[model samples]
Structure formats: structure tokens, C-alpha cells
Target chain A: MEERTVCEMCDNPPEDEGYELPLCANCRDELSRCPFPLWVKLISGLVLLLVLIAFVNFPSSLRAAAAFERGNKAKSKGNYPTAILEYERALARFPDSTVTMAPLAAACGWDGDLRKFAYYLEKLDGREIRADLADEIEEILLEFEDLSEMEGDEQ
Target chain B: MIIPGRLIALVTFPGVIVHEIAHQLFCRLCGVAVLDVCYFRFESPAGYVEHEPPRRISQHVLIGIGPFIVNSLLGAFIALPSAVAVLQFEAGTVLDYILVWLGVSIAMHAFPSVADAKSIWQAIWSEGTPTLTRLMVTPVVGLIYLGALGSFLWLDLAYGVVLAVGFPYLLVSLLT
Candidate 1:
């Protein structure tokens, strides 16, 4: 028996039914012509251009979250340098973002970068820390003490 | 494993490339005035082709399918020589064998391309589908691609898996 592939957009057999995940045939035909008046197209084009510029120029909130994820992953893998790199990236992308700062500071503390941690703490707005995160950071710092001692002995 | 990783990387590189090319190709075919292409690579690189998004879903789907169609052919070509070289690898040094394995692995996993993801995301976000339909379609489509590939065994499959996992990270970095 031949294996059948379904249409990706809509969950139907692509061969048996006309494709409609993105659009059916009639809808596709209709969209070919500009739906807006000519003026609307011009205005929307200009607006989109502006939005594009702004999106690029602005500090990215999404990047902050991504950086935090990367940092967490790196920490779990015991890659302190990589974790720091991710945190630094987050800081660069979203200087004023609290979400970036808190985890970044925590990572720095774990890496024994006390001065860096202090810097991030200073920059952080005075929001109360959640109990879970505060405890986690404390544990990371305590663990880092042993890590640094081991490194010191190895040297 | 070494050969597989390299093959996987080789296959993976083209997924992003094909996705962009698909967009550009469809624009030209639709008689739309092509302006320029802005391309983004890895986490840091970003660029775009200078044409408006197509008004029609058919045009969009054509562009979306471009990467899958192109890369699948490319993957086949890559896999053929790689498999041959791999079979002839008895005399090869450790490094030579490693390279071959990497190459083969990457080629095998190099498909169901990310252009499909972008196409799905755009279709969901556009006025093309009703709100309820859009909600239903977007996650379902994304999960299908992602969930299916979670267990893919080949090297090229690994590349696709990495891309699937990493692309969202890239998107978050770029969009936010």
C-alpha cells in the first residue's frame, strides 16, 4: 500500500481534496488581486516598512527570554563560559529588561563573577525576588564555592 | 558518527538557504516586482528579499514547498556519493571515516524543510484563515512537523531535528 501524506495546513489528503491549509482554490484566486484600495497598499507598505525598522531598532523583549533559556541550558551542561555568553547576549539585547537581568545576575553569581553579579543587581529594578528563584540562586552560589575551590587546587 | 555529523551539517545548512530561495522564487513566478532579499543565518545574521508577501495562498504554498522540493533533490545527490564513499571506507583513516559519516548523517535528516514552518506561521497570522481555524491549524501543524521528527534516526534527520528545535529559539531572538 502506498503511504499517503496529508496536506500540512489542513489535515486532509492532499491528492483527494484541493489544497486548503493556507487557502482553498477560490480563496487563493481572490487574494491574487490586491484586496485593498491602491492607497491602502501604499500606506500599508509605508507602515510596514516603518514597523520593520522599529522592530529591528528596538530592544528585543523576545531575545531576553531566549538568552535566559540558553543560559539555563548552558548551566545545566556545566558550561559556565557558554552560560555567561548567553547572559551577556541577553543583557546586550534587552538592557532594561528585568527578566534578562535577574537570571543573568544569577548566572554570574554561579560563575563566581561577583562584580558582574553586583553590576546586574544594581541595574535591576527593585522587584521582590520569588522564593523559588532566590533559593535556586543561593544554591548555585554555594555550589560555585566548591567549584572555584576545585579549580584553584587544579591550578 | 563523525561523518554523519558533517553530512548532517551539510544537509542542514541548505534548509535555511532553501527557505529563503523559495520565497524569492515564488515572488518572481507570481509576476510580483522582486525588490531584494534579506537573509538571516544562525542567531545573528538577518536579511530579506525586497518583495511584498504574496496575496494568494497558492502563491504562498508554492513558495513554501520550494525548500522541500529543492532540498530533497539535493539531499538525494549528496546521499549517493556519500553512501558510496562510506562503503569504500575500509582503507580510510579515522578522520576520513568520520567525515563521511557526518556527511551521510546530515544528508539523511535534511528535510521537511523550515519553509513549511514559515508558511504555516504566516498563513495562521494572515487574514487568510478565520480566527478559530487559525488557532486550530497553527499549533497542530507545528506539532506535526516537530513531533514526527522527534524520533527520526538518520543523520540528516538529526539536522532537521536540531533545526526544528533551534529555529524557534532563533525566531524568539529575532522577533522579540
Candidate 2:
């Protein structure tokens, strides 16, 4: 014998098929509403909005990071011009980023752009930087020094 | 070591609320009827979604794991810029801290509850359950139990940190 099915909530004939819960369209809609408290709705809505904002803003940051990566790769490969360009691109997206700035300064120094390198190095003075980067910068500065003018009498 | 779940839920209420929402949303998506739901409360369970048993194993799996997918992605996305700025670039604002907190709070609750594992186990082991499902899903259930056990050691908090903060750092590092 064929059995008849009915809505579990309203006890009416089911309107939608393929549902494990025997509910008509109206009851299904009602259940979907959830009736969560107002604050929960507000908070969840706020979260979704914030996440959307972040997602929207993410591409720029991602591009900046990618550009920074390209810069590092270029610098390592002695492609100083490409590295400088990529670093500039990253700086455009992430302005005043010390990490990017330090690397940019180092790249300029390696490329022998003394004017730009000295400018960046002077700007970085007294700024807290990674020890290794500080050492690299110091070495770059030493490259400009004359050995005879040095006061080291240990020779 | 045996602190109540309610206290933890109260502290991380956002995660609890989102977890319940994820469950309800999946139920709606699967065309299942939700009998009841509590997004958050100062109770033993903290939050819950009562819904009809799904007709398919795939639906059940989705419903059980919905929070893991939603919370992880949301949390990680929410934390990405802030985490990278503060942790990697050493630059951030007050707003970044707030966003990081929210992200960590959400990610902290990504694991499926042990009860969800038990239900899935029952469904998979029941009569007529496909062999493929049994093989594929058992590991998930095991992991859920392990997660439940690890919660005693605050592994959930660590998981949150790794997902929401560490992931973005890893992403940036990989690109470089």
C-alpha cells in the first residue's frame, strides 16, 4: 500500500519534495527564518560586512605582496632595475612599509644608485630595523669610505 | 583542566554564535527543516541547531562540517591584512587589533563538536551506508574526537592562531 506524507510542522500535505523533513513551503520558510535574537543578527550581519570589506580590500594587499616577492626574486638574481620597479610597486600599495623600504634601499645600494641609496639610508637612520638588515646597510655605507681616512691603527 | 564549556563559549561567544549560524545555514541550504536553534546562551551547550536528519550522507557531512569551512575562511580573511601588517610588516592600527581579535575568536570554534562526530559515525555505520563513505569519513570522525580531546590543552586556541594569523603570514612568505 502506498503511504501518504504530510508536513511535520503544520500537518498539511508537503509542498516541496526531496526534503527529509516533511514540511510544506510555508513551514519551511518559517523554519528558515530561525528567529535568532536581535543582537545575534546584528553581530552576524556586522561580521559579514566586515569580512566583505576585507575580501574587497584583499586583492590590493595580495598584489603588493606578490610585487614584493617579485622584487626579492629580481634582487637575488642581480636584476636590480626590475627589483627596484617591483619594490616601488609594493611601496605604492603598502606605503611606509619598513620591510619593503629596507629591501628597496638595499637594492638601490647594490644597483650603485648612490644618490637614491644614500637618501634611503639617511631616512632609515635611527629607525629600528632587523639586525641583519642594519648590518647590510652598514656594509653598504662602508663601501663609500676611503681606507686611508679610516682611524683604525691596528694595521 | 576541566573548565566548563559555557565559560569558554562565553569568552568566545562570537565563534559559538557563528557555529550555530553555520549549522542553520547548511540546513536551509540542504532544504532541511530546522526544529530549533539557539545562537548563543550561557548554558552547557552554549549554542545549538536542531534540525531534521538529512536524507543523504553528503548532506550530513556538510551540515556537520559547515562551521569548519565558514569560520576558517571568514576568520582567515578577516585576519589577513591585519595579521600581515602587525606581524610581518610591523605596522598596524587600533582597528587591526580589533579585527584580529574577532578573527581569532571566530576561528577558535572551527572544529566540529564531538557529538557531531558521533552522529556522523552512526550515519556512516548504519545499514546500507556506502563503503566509500565509511572509508572516507572515518578519519574525520577520528579527528573530531582528537580535537575534542585536545581542547583540554587549548589546542583550539592554537588552531585559531595558526589558521587566522599563521596562514596569512605563510601566504605572504610563499609569494615572496
Candidate 3:
């Protein structure tokens, strides 16, 4: 979704602030009316609010966007597992989404899961992969081959 | 609401809760009083935990173990039947729908909050040998969480379902 302010709890990127977990002002005020303990009600309200926002903003078609964002962040942070998780989410939701699949395959290639990279590449037909990403995937394949050779030597 | 739905993020949050519940259960096993537990998210969504601080890594790990146990069991129990029903039925009936819903529900729960993950990561990072022990436990935990994610990926529906289900895990993971 749109990042508005620094998250209230964790002060991360400035883009994610201001807004409460999921609710904008309109929704939060309504939830505040619940009869539960003020604190519990508030938290429950906030969480529920976030859910609503997620649904509205992060629709099926946009899942690719979410995946792209997630993969981008995870790749940058060296969290390959997490990045792949996001890319996988994108793939599942938007199976035909070429925008995300290419990057995701490149990421898989980086992780040495060439089977998946090739799988997605085949899906790409003759479409050109991004120049930079193609190079990156090629580099990874080379490294993976070299590593396997090293393993062979050790054996 | 949308945000709480995010709270239920697949890999990061639901998994974290399973892990935390693991820690909580072990704490109970070891005779520790459980106070409160939370995982964090940011801006519109976050989590918190207010608990009596444990003096030992063992206690910490026990609480961490909570989500792993919960999700693994949940994944096996819910996903199995759902898988069967989905396979057996061509066009879904109400009951099949219910089963599918149940399976998705269980599967959606397959992650940890990054917030909680960070805390555990910190706990592990801060300790040397203790961290190794924590690392050992994490894979077991992640395996179950992965099962939950696998279920969702296999089922593979619309983005809203995945995001509604998966975002919370990421939110929790990333924020923490």
C-alpha cells in the first residue's frame, strides 16, 4: 500500500509513519466505539483496520506490486528466504504477471534455484529479460557451476 | 479490518505467533507465568508483548517455540482434510467451501512477525552458544511455517486472499 509515515511502533523509513497500523482516521474512530476494554478494543480496532486497508489497497491485480515491493526490500537486505517468499506470493496471486515473474526468476537464479529460473524463463517465451537482470542471472549460474566444480574437487 | 488481516500475514506473523506460542507453552512447561505477548507492525499495523521478563535463554526459547508447534499442528490438521475435500469435490459445496476456508485460514497462519523475529534474532545474535541453540530451534519452527505457506501456494487463489492472509506475516516480520 501507500506508505504515509513512520510506523508508530518502529521508527523505520519515513514513508511508513503517521497512519495507525491499518486504519485511517475515519475507520479508527468508528472502532473506538467498541465496548471492550479500551486498550484491547483499540488494538483490535487497529488490526482490523489494517486488514481493511490491505484488502482495499492490495487487491489481486496489485499483488504483483506487493511482491515487487517485498522482493525488492528482501533482496536489498540479504534476506533471500523472505524475498523469495514475497516473490512466491506475487507469483501465486498473479500467475500471468510478467512484470514480477521475471524479477522473481532472476532472484531464484541468484539463490541458485535455476530450475525455477528456467521454469519462469520458459514461460517468458522469446520476450527479452531485462538486460541487467539477465546478466545477474547469468553470473549466478556461472558461480553455481564453479561452486559445484569446487565441491567436485573436494570430493 | 484490513490491517488486522495484515496482522495475520502468512510467513512472518502467523508463523511468529506459532513460534511465540511455542515459547509461551515451553515457559508454561517450565512453570513460568505468561503475562502478555505481541508482535509488532508499523504505521497502521503493529504488535506488542508485555510479559514478565525471563532470566534465562531457556525461558526465552520456550516462548519462541510457541508458534512452531501451533502452526505445524494446525497446518497438518487443517490442510490435510481441506486438501482431501478439494480433491474429492469437483465443484465446491458449502461444506467444501467451509473446508477450503478452514484450510486457507490455517494456512494463512503460517508465518512469524518480523518484529518478533527480530527480537528472537536479537536474542540469538546477542548470545553465542545460546544463539546456536535458538538457530537450531528456528528451522524446526520455519519448517512448519513453510508448510503453512506451501498449502497457500498450492491452493493459489486471488491476490486479496493471499495478501489478506499473507501481509500480516510480512508486516510483523518487516516491522520487527
* Interface CA RMSD of each prediction in angstroms: 20.6, 4.2, 19.0
Per-model DockQ:
0.04, 0.29, 0.02
lDDT of 3 by residue, B1-176 (tens): 12234434443443333344444555555444344555435322334444433445555555554554565455444333223223321222354345345445533443444444544555555534455677676664465455435534542223224433344335434533
Per-residue lDDT of model 3, residues A1-155, tens digit only: 76545423245432222222433333333332222235645754654454344334233424444465778789878777778888787667556656566677777776767788789878866766668777776787688889999999999
Report per-candidate TM-score of chain A alone: 0.52, 0.69, 0.53
Q: Which docking band does candidate 1 fall into?
A: incorrect
* Worst lDDT 10-window in candidate 2 chain B: B84-93
Provide C-alpha RMSD values for all models, in order.
20.9, 5.2, 21.7
**Candidate 2, B41-97: lDDT as tens digits:** 898688889887777888888899999998888778788767766555555566666
Candidate rank order under DockQ: 2, 1, 3
True contacts kept of each: 0.08, 0.43, 0.00
Best by TM-score: 2
What is the lDDT of every predicted structure here?
0.50, 0.81, 0.50
